[model samples]
Target: MSRFTDFFVRNKKKLLIGIGGFASVIMIGFVVFLLNRERILKYAVAKAIQKVENKYPAKLKIGNARFLDLNTVLVTDIALLPNDRPKLMQIDTVEATVSFRSLFLGRMVFKQFDMAQGAITAFKQDSVDNFSFLYKKQAAGETVDSTAKKTSNYGTLLNRLIETAFENVPDGVNFRNLAVLFKNDGRTINMNLPTMLVEDGEINARMTITTEALTNTMYVKGVIDPDNYLLAAKFYGDNQSKSIEVPYIQQKFGATMRFDTLSLSITNKVYKNNQLTISGESSAYGLVLNHPKIADENVTVQNGAMKYVLTLGDHYYALEPESEVRINKAIFYPEATYETRPKRKIGIKINSPDIPANDLFASLPPGLFDTFQGVQATGTFKYRMNFFVDMAQVDSLKFDSDLDASPDFNITQFGPVDLRKLNQEFTHTVYEKDKVVRTFQVGPSNPNFTPYNQIPNHLKYAILTAEDPRFLTHKGFHEGAFRHSLITNIKENSFVRGGSTVSMQLVKNAFLTRKKTITRKVEEALIVWIIENLRLTNKERMFEVYLNIIEWGPNVYGIREAARFYFSKEPSQLTLEESLFLASIVPKPKQYRTYFDAYGGLRAYPRYFFKLISGNMLKRGLISPSQAASVSTYVNLSGRAGSFIIPKPDTTHVQLMDTLQLAPIDLLDF
Candidate 1:
């Protein structure tokens, strides 16, 4: 060590001189690079613009690029022309700050970008959108929200080049007064950003969207985490006079919906393990769902509040489990959820407490409410209902409803009716294709009109047993039939079969058309209550009217006409087998011709259905076991119309068929 030190001491002056000369040379090079920095920045801008133009059919222009400092570059008066359009995007100034450390690695990395005073316009030309590059259509066999791959190879290269241009944006990206215009088909929307600050994977944005065509304006402000797509902070939105136009809503609900003023506030919080919990409350005023059929009675939610919840990645939003919406005097608590599990599903349950009948009537349009013009109703009724759909198949639907009420109701036109005075005749109109054909005299007009006593006992029993076995016992409705029919209809998502009692059917025929609408059903139920509880009609009177007015064939009305049309016989002479066959087609009497085959015999299904009804009758004690056995397993309809003869019952069989007791009724049970 002493020898090395002595050697260095001898060469110390020369070594010091050499080190100073090397340092001077590096300093001179730095001075020269600093002087020519502007030239290098211009060259880089020209090259970037040229590269972008070569990839896409867009032109880029910049008035000048200058250095604000050694670490910052400012570009002024930039304009971008997409296709042949003039200046789709215009910016007054843009500044980027470079990372000094990245310069040592031979890369120009931006630490921040200030993109200010920019205007962008997007429009559709033919079938192509100006900003179509932002979205690539999904290929076949993909879900609706699935991510799609980028379309073009040039897009991939362009994206890489863009990423490289701004490699290290560590601090933030800021925007000021950026105008965005969008036009597509027949709609024009304009949005302006007042300010936006993006930093550390979080963004706080403020914007206002407006449309002159809709007379609407939407103001939105939110803090979002783009990396995880979370609302890390908060979001608030206000939409005023936002008239939404949706054709499907008009078709489905028979209405057009519009919101006059709406406000929403939301907050997102992370619980544990990065689980996101979002809660929000929305309120709207002057909302209307306008329907043409109810021109004067639009369904409206003048002002209402809704509370909701959403969990990220679960693809579902839930409403308050117990929340009530009060429109006028009616209050309904509805629980609803819409979910996505690759496929979509929906469920809704509504429970309403007792509501005044007059309040409900006032909410309905005159076109519907007038159907019960002569009935006086005074009371409250409560009902609960549920509906569900899974995987877009309506077959998975389940709906259940129940109504409870105690009303002081009656028919104004007819005072409390008397069963003994039912001998009076009346006129009725027949409807075909929803139009009245002719006013016809119904009761007592036909010479073959049979009295209730003269009507064959087995025929009466068969109709009662097939249609409604609980007819004499039930005051107005049969709970068992209703439940069964409700289940079937919900499973099919259609009202294919009706579970109406004889009393209800009689009222429907006497006062309403067979339109199968909710309005019709409600009115029918109201009328049934009036007739049963008010004693406007008795069980025997309703059954008699149902028999007289029910459709038997295309134009055939009543059992008397059906008997003559099918067998050229009187209603009193219909044999047990013939009566069963007649009862089988009561639901679709107009299509009865189809039940007969080419050989003019009752088809297998019709015969089997008859046996089913007959078997039920035997089980319910409406018909004797022997009487059911006597009916042939197969119904034989001769080819010659009206040639099938009615078989007379033996003397022993007549007494059994004649003496069957009527079901005892308890009117107060209603």
Candidate 2:
């Protein structure tokens, strides 16, 4: 170090003068560079774009890419997809400067900024839409209640996020609020939202998304009365005066309970299928439940069927014919346990080729065919639906297929056909199409299609008290119910035990074949499990469907038809005596004729079976002793005489042949 200093001292004055001149020039050059910062920035931006294109292999369509004075981006355009239209995006125009502190300290610090108009648009699937800027909440009332806010974790976290992002925002990125929208009117939709924060996976967005897929989107872009949405309930709620469109709204329900303690309620509203909905402005932490009122509301009578509207709080439920039935739609919600709703009586319409009457008759249980005195046909036929809502209401009835030409009738070949005799019995087998497939006809008491919704409530309670007491509280497949049935089976050593709920009855009746394979039973169990989560409770439509489509003899389908055939009277007129007869024979239709000697037998069921089922009903508070005693008596089971042949009118004729033709049956139970 000493040697070097001695050498430098010899030329210290010359070195000092020379170094001073160089230092002055360098400082002067730097000052000039800062003054012309805009030019340098432009050059840098151009180079950066070129590098970007070279660095990544892509064919991105870019438009109006710019760099203004002092790192300002005046205008920009980026196209993510191919379209016939052009996309424009603009940030507020302004003059700004780069922060020298950031440049030297490796920290981002900007200053001097301004903004103007900015908009973002994205189109997909023949729709147009746009996104806009946001405004902060400015309300009068208090939400946190001061004391709670002091100890709120979420409140504190929100505070931190706002503080961190704005620290280095600077004036360069300033902009006025954004304005964006989307509009479509016919079979199309366009929508957009700009400047959104998508934290985690859920979105807390306040924007509009409109589409032209329905009748109208303009009229449907706001709040609506929730009750009108239900298909069945709409008819009774003054639909004639006002009908509205709803394209972007849905309600979500939540509960914290289990069997006997099951509790549920709805929460914040969201767009359809939950696009980007948030909590109510003043929603509480927990939601309160509004259970549906069935049969308790008004019902409409139309087209020979009763139309009952069921509402859960203000939301609409299903629309179905009047009859005895069950749905698991939050079925046991009142019980507050883990239970699921099954696919039941409700169904969606489909557009498919009609099934030949002959083809449908070919699909029946092995021996069940030809067993009925005037029975007919074989094989399976089905229709294809365009869309569907496969809920409990839909699950109850089996959707075989629309009937084609009847037994020997053809629609295309029009001949002399008597319209007045459509349902009348004929000597020659006649096929009919479009006739409602069911087990019985409904009068005020029967209420076939829209029978009073109240009827099912009463009937279900009765049936439940008469059948399974635990139906309301258990999941679809009740192990306890199963165990009891097994014990009974062991005692009697017979397959006369069934712990299946009304839901299970619908399943086995509608879908599964008559085979007693474990695999098939397993499938039934699984479907029942699904029903527990997805269906409603008891329904009148369900029972009506069960009775109408069920066979009593050859072609004897519904309770209406059966009532007329057996008693020569309307179903509504059949007293308790006749109703019990119907219930007794249902469990074993094939054996009905044999056991009753043609339904001339046990008006009541087997000893243990009746007690077990009836006891369950009693425990559930479904029936009175009078009702039980009335159901226990037999109207005409006076002797062991299997003379249960369907009654025919004097005008009705039956053609007998070695190979007699009969109507197909839907004996859908084991």
Candidate 3:
């Protein structure tokens, strides 16, 4: 023990000297590394470029790279070129300052960034594109398991994406002459930012966008907090007279949209407990849109705004119920949710508090509601709708919509077409493919016009059974038929059936054009609801107008004309079989001759329709079993329609009673 202690004391001084020398060596090496860090960063960047080139069918070039300061890097003459294609991107110079600590943590947080003379070009010709290499290619022979029960953290993924995007947006920036160009199939779009600056979290930018139709200069001014993912921006054209035209839509979708000014704000973005919540507001002024499917003319809105709260979780995305949408003086709350797990389902709800009738009328888009353009009204109305659908069980979908008016609600003055005209004698016009085909008077004053009481009960019941079974009892919309139609359309992925009730048909024939547009359909529905709920006309009068105005045969415009055109008799004098035959041809009035054989006898398809209609009428107690049993599918087209038939042998003489038990009633038979 004594010897060991003596030896330790003797070497203690030497040991201390050795340890100090080793520490000094490490400190000196670290200092040397810090001094040459720029070279190391450049090497790392070169290696990254090499990796990218090897993986993608593209080449990246950097003319010069060096460190400007401890954390700032300056790169010049950078270009990326895809093989056998035009250059994808080019930059004259780029300077960026990244957080040193973040770099060590495998993240690049840009504190400041500056770029000058940059251009990005995306081109496509035929089946080839310059930017295709940027997309990661799926491995060959790999198959996706669509039925796999996999749940994704949508909130987490979206939050990470947003954070990553915002991390690259520097707090201070100076950008100049950045142009982005896209060309495809002879169509070109160019957007150039002449100058953009971000100083102290305030942004100012000037941009010019050019397309085939127009060129516009736009200004963007905003305040941003990139770290917190908050931004408020205002984008406007050079002047109030100019509007920013949304690119691509006009060419790609055959729709045009433009706005004079748009304001957007992202007030908050928060992710907590695997849930991401975002709140924002968007408003636009002087917005105009035109689409053939929506309307025939441009629809213009003076002001529109929305305040929204959006939430995302593991398997669902939702717009909170607190979100509010405003149009002029009207306001509504909307809520929507989409879920991918535990059965894919989507639900939407919208409700509006009582809004003044005048405000509602005034808020309508100018060209969209042309019929109600100068309409004046008083009192108030509220609207609410709830819609839900499970993709797995679409048949169980739920849709409920309502619009309720106050007791005193009234239209003080009429617009283009007076709603009260149907109560008295009025002129009705028929349109085919947007062309005026026939114009006729729809009243007792017209010789061929048949009054409601003059129409045969058999014809009315047959038509009701064929077209809308619940037209007398329900509102303008038949929910069951609509649900069935929706299910069928969803299954077919096409609009094969329209659940048009008699009331809707009446409204369309009376006040709307037969343009087959979404706007027209919506207008027809609204008008039907208004007429029915407001009692503008009685059910008898509406149905009477429908029977009179609806086309029956070539140029046939009324029940009286139809009876003479097909059966050579008055509507009140038509028999049950003739009524059934007339109802069967109502859907294809122009093609009525197709239902009959060359011998003027009803074909098999029309025979099937006859049995279906009569069976339904029997079930509804509209006709006695004896009447249904006595019905025949045979028809002797003794009028003008008989001239169009051929002389083929009658091969469709099956008894209506025998087929009545075999044929299933289809509400859409009409």
Q: Summarize candidate 3's per-residue lDDT along 193-267 as a digit string, tens digits.
A: 999999999999999988888887999999999867898999998865478888889778999999999999988
User: What tens digits encode model 1's per-residue C-alpha lDDT throughout 242-308?
Assistant: 4533334554576776655555544333333323444655666666666654433455665566555
Candidate 2 wrong stretches, greater than 4 Å: 1-32, 47-115, 126-174, 177-466, 469-670
lDDT for model 2, on a 0 to 1 scale? 0.36
**Highest TM-score model number:** 3
lDDT of each: 0.62, 0.36, 0.82
| Candidate 3 Cα lDDT to native | 0.82
List runs of model 1 lying over 4 Å from the truth: 1-317, 338-347, 372-377, 386-400, 406-427, 441-451, 475-498, 529-536, 633-670
Please say which candidate is ahead in TM-score: 1 or 3.
Answer: 3
Candidate 2 residues 97-192, lDDT tens each?
A: 555434333332445444344454433334332211011221323121213322212223322333334343453333344444333333333433
List the candidates' TM-scores in order: 0.57, 0.29, 0.81
Q: CA shift at 210, candidate 1, in angstroms? A: 12
**Candidate 1 C-alpha error for residue 212, in Å:** 15
Runs in model 3 lying further than 4 Å from the true structure: 1-62, 65-74, 80-88, 95-110, 123-160, 183-187, 270-278, 310-320, 337-346, 647-670
2 versus 3: better TM-score goes to: 3
